[model samples]
Structures are given as C-alpha cells and as structure tokens.
Target: MNALAIENLSHSFGTRQVLQNVSFTVAEGRMCILLGRNGAGKTTLFSLITGLYYARTGLVRVFDMAMQANPSAALAQMGVVFQLPTLDLDLTAGENLRYHAALHGLPTKLSKARSREELSRLEVLDRIDDRTCALSGGQRRRVEIARALMHGPRLLLLDEPTTGLDVPGRRALEQHVRDLCRERGIAVLWATHFLEEVAADDDVVVLDRGRVCWAGPADRIAPELGVGSVAEAFALLTGSP
Candidate 1:
C-alpha cells in the first residue's frame, strides 16, 4: 500500500477555495517533491494532511489511515516539519527532543537512544545540550528534523524545509532527507518552490493556482516543458501568458 495518498482533495476559507480536486500518492520508501509558487495552497494541503484544518471535501490518507476520520492515528504514523519552526527556543536541543518524545508517548529509554543516534546522524550531536536559541537557523532546522524522527515515523512531511538556509546548508539538509529515504526507507513529501531542491530522479508534482498541473518523474517534466532546468520547466507549465 502507498505510504501517503490523497484523492480529489478540496478545501477553502469561506469564499476562497484553496485546493481543488487534488490527487496524488507517495509510494513506500520514495520521495515526492511538491512544487508550487507562493499562496498556491501548499500549507493548506499540509494542514489538511496533518489535521490542523479539515478539507471541505475529498480524502487524505496516511499509512492507509484516513486523516479526517482518524487524525491521531494518521499523525502517529507520520512526522512533520512545518514551514515555520516549532522549536522551543528556551530549551536545550536535548530537552526539546525529550519533550517531543513525551508528546508522542515514546518510551523514555528508547527515545533517548534514538535521539542520540538521530542527532549524530544529522551531525548535530555536539550541540544536543546547548540551548536551541543559541543555534543558527540551519542548526535549528536540523534539530527540528531530528525531533520529527523521534517516533520513527514511516512517512515524513516537510513544508519548505530549506527556506532560510544558505546554499551549502540547503544542500546538507536536502542530502540528509534523501538519506532518510535511502537508509531508513522513509517516504518524504517535501513541499517547496525552489526547483534546485528537486533531484533528477525524484518524483515531481506541480501545484498551480490551487490545482495540480503535472505529476510525474522529474526528468519527464523537463522534456515535456521544453526546458533544460526544472525552474524553466515549472515556468513553462505554470507561467502567466
């Protein structure tokens, strides 16, 4: 079964309709990159998937569990890193992870061991005991990612995760996420506007004006759009006339 699935999903805020007939799936152990411009309903989709907001219509399934009917179950089977950081700036990185562990009902011993391993894997072990507010943007982002994995979710949802990082920082975080897909076989649904973040082998889904315009392999999009780069391909597909 697919790790994440959505069918004809639609949502709106009063008069403003956001997502319309959105449909997609993320196969187990694969990465799906969600591409869209600003105000394209990326967050809206995330909200629906995570149960922060209910969709006006359609289905959102995570791990074969329906998000609307059983949001807690669906969420427990997944992890999330929102576009905005949710870290407790006043706490140390280790403390932050501990808090997350408790929130997820994880066993203390197991959570601690996993926290140490995750921080090391993300290359932030040296700062585990340091206050989160003392870290740089990239460092904080990494911690948030590590915390997301505390429950060992089968699927990871990241919304504009590389937004504020520099070139190298962005590259590092991207590689880390890809590594998660490769090593742990965790499926990732990465939402972003930057084409550079899309890997040549990754699956691509383009959202334009609250609708999905294209959904296929990244390489396939380049040829279809008559473009050499993903950015240009996106423009060709969703650009203004």
Candidate 2:
C-alpha cells in the first residue's frame, strides 16, 4: 500500500508559484529520498503535506487519508523532523522526549517505555540525561528522531536530517534510519541535498524549481546524471550544465 500519495499538487505565494503538478507515491515500508536544491520548494511541499500551508489546488493523502479534511487523523500516523533544530537547548534529552510525549497525549508509562526503547535504538540512551546543548550535533539529531518516533508513527518525514554531521556521523545515522525503516516497516520521506544519503537501490524523487524532474531508483539513473553521487544526479537532472 502507498503510505503517501500526492497528485497534481500546486501551491503559490502571491504571484510566485512554489509547486506545480507535483506527484509521487511512497510505498509502505520504503525509504524515499526527496532531492532538490535550495529554494526548490521542498519545504513548501512538506508544509502542504503537514497541513501547515493549505494547498491552492490538488490533493495530498497521508496513510490514505486526505490531509486537508482530517489533519489530526493524518498527523497521528505521521512524524516529522524539520531541517532546523527544534530541541530546547537547556533541556536534557530525556526531558525533551517527555515533553513531546505529553504534547502527543500518549500515556505517561507508555511514553517513558517507548522513549527508552527509541533512544536505545538510536544509540543515544547513554546521553538521555545530558542537555541537548552539550550533545554533539549528530547525537542531538538522534534525540530529535527518537522523540519523533515515540508516538510509533507509521510514516516518518525528515527534512535535511544530516545537515551538520561529519562523515562518520552521517553514515551512522543513515544506517540507523535504514534499520528503523526496515525493522518497523515505516514509510520514510527523507528530504536531502546530499548524495551519500542515496543508497544503491533506494527510490529517489528529484525536484527542480518546484517540480518533479525524475522519480525512480537511484541505481538506475544514468551514470553521468548521478555523476559522482545522487547530488550530482540531481544537479544534472535539474539542468546544471
């Protein structure tokens, strides 16, 4: 089953169009990478999906439900980690997770149990009591991810999830994310500009100027298109000459 299906989605800000006829399907249990350049309308698209910005036209469905008509229902099954850091700097990771759990209205006992499991899964259990400000960038990101998963969302959305991490950090987080998707069968929509995030067989959607230019498996793209990696493929597909 498709976890997310967007069709003919269009959005605009006054005279400027942000997305036009954007369409794609993210299968259940699959990890789909959304690739685009800065100002390519990735954030705009996510806003629409999350119901932060109503779509001017077209339809967006999450877990097979219309997002516009039932935002709460759709959101209940989805978890999102935005590009920017959202944690409270002074709060410990455990405290941050507890706050998120309360916000979601999960049972306290269940929330604590799930939070512990998630933190361990992300390899941040040891740092659970440490303030977010004191944690490394990658460790903090993991905490954010763990918080997102506390609700056991069926679909996960990440925007620029590995922005500041070093090579090892990025790879570690990638493996963790991959394992989470496979083990939990959660559909993932990972938005990024980096090529390393594009695994050999992963599906990719390339957006340019707010439109989808390509949607297929990473390994199948032309060698020249991907060039050295997926970022290069995105550049080539978007007409970078």
Which candidate's lDDT is highest?
Answer: 1
- Local accuracy of candidate 2 as per-residue lDDT tens digits, 1-241: 7999999999999999999999998999999999888899999999999898998699989978999889899989898998899999999999899899998899989988888999999989999888999999999999999999999899999998999999999999888889999999999999988867888878899999999998988787657463666656666788774
Q: Candidate 1 on 3-39: residue-level lDDT in tens?
A: 9999999988888988899999999999999999999
Per-model TM-score on C-alpha atoms? 0.97, 0.94
Segments of candidate 2 deviating more than 4 angstroms = 223-232
Candidate 1 error regions (>4 Å)? none
Superposed Cα deviation of residue 19, candidate 1 (Å): 1.1
